[model samples]
Target: MPDRVLVAYGTKNGSTAQIAEAVAEVLRKDGLDAEALPAGSVTAVEPYDAVVVGGGLYAGRWHKDARRFVRRHRRSLAGRPLWFFSSGPLDASASERDIPPVPGVRRAMTELDVIGHATFGGRLEEGAKGRMARMIVRSGRGGDFRDFTAVQAWADRVGQELTAAGRR
Candidate 1:
């Protein structure tokens, strides 16, 4: 059997979830066994050899559940290869330089010793967000800024890492 990889994500409007699914697909395409699951639904980390956690950024913060998952299972996670990604910086002008680390993410990174981290752009649809989120989206502050090429490239790298780890 292929080595198992768990892709867990927290999403508000489903953008991050979709991204997680895409990442899982890429990994599976490379012959790795992968599954995309919600962060809240993940009760244990014992089934997987490697893990990828993703979350949507809201007001410069990762979703609380994503943070909690890492915290609650830090010990198990520390023993495995871990990767992290965030869906943020939705504006057209959003660039790596413009998007700094979110506070929760930064804190989790230190505790988890995450091996890789990425920031992907997110999407906001009309009439799909709460009043505050709508305001944030309407302020010309958000768009579907996801660059699929970059995301796929990162997945490829993760595949290579997983392959190398399996050989060891």
Candidate 2:
């Protein structure tokens, strides 16, 4: 059970960060104390009663910053409720199974005893992408795929769990 929750995310062009913030907003609306922050900037997990880590997924890989943050704080996050999320795939109809969490996430999810994981639709802006990413976007795989409704619903579910679990 956790009252103070940290919704941390790693993003290259800010899509994942925006989703994280929205998740925090939902959690706050649910009467929980929560904060949205860039994963790379978060140095400690001690202050948080729970943590939600998210990142932009690309080519079956999670963001390096998000991965690093989890690895560095794995011990600190051993308990107290933890979850992971990723934003990728251009189609909302596509199951998360089509674009699964990377190997690193699989390992951390198991080792950390993560409560759950979600994969949401992602957005790709041409100018924001790097060389390789831009190439992919140029090939016509870019648009706003974020489903806010889905995000809110997922947040609400997590918030309910946190609420029921009660403050630690």
Candidate 3:
């Protein structure tokens, strides 16, 4: 709808990146031009009419890149639609339970007039993560808990919102 949409992500072990790509795909299918780029590559928000930022949650915190992106572009973001999502809750068994929002995310929402914020289950790869991440994954801390249906549903909602806003 906005002629261009940017889906930026900060991923650990690639799960969140995959999720960002999926969201971008769904947005494209909805007749919007969307691209999923790593947060580090995004120097500014000048090219997109809408922005969707996502990152994995670690120890109740979002990735640094994602946090920095929002902080750096807070002003630009305020003039446009912005959505945030965190990939966490790795315990698949806890999929049905209500996951709490990460503190950083909560603060971001309060400080910025974000349109929406969501928490999606994250993944824990066996050997892909760094020492700390792997240790956490191995210590029975998290599991592969992503729900595709829910992720797609959220993406669709974002697409609809962007479309409606474009019309206005």
Which numbered prediction scores highest in lDDT against the true structure? 2
For residues 1-168, write the lDDT of model 1, one tens digit per residue: 338999999888888999899999999988899999999899999999999999998887888778788888899998888899998676643345445467778787777788888888888877656797788767866567887777888898998889877777
Clash totals for all candidate models: 0, 0, 1
Model 2 regions more than 4 Å off: 94-100
Worst 10 residues of 3 by lDDT: 92-101
Task: Provide the lowest-lDDT 10-residue window in model 1.
Answer: 92-101
57-128 in candidate 3: lDDT tens per residue? 877789888888888888888877888888877676335765655778888877777888778888886786
Q: Taking the tens digit of each residue's C-alpha lDDT, what string does model 2 give over 56-154?
A: 997788888898899889898897689888997787653434455678787889999999888888888778758877876899878878888888988
Candidate 2 TM-score to native: 0.92
Candidate 3 lDDT score relative to the true structure: 0.84
Cα distance off (Å), candidate 1, residue 65: 1.7
In candidate 2 the C-alpha lDDT for residue 22 amounts to 94
- Using TM-score as the measure, name the better of candidate 1 and candidate 2: 2
- Candidate 3 residues lying further than 4 Å off, grouped into runs, are 140-142
Would you list the C-alpha lDDT of every candidate in the order shown? Answer: 0.84, 0.87, 0.84
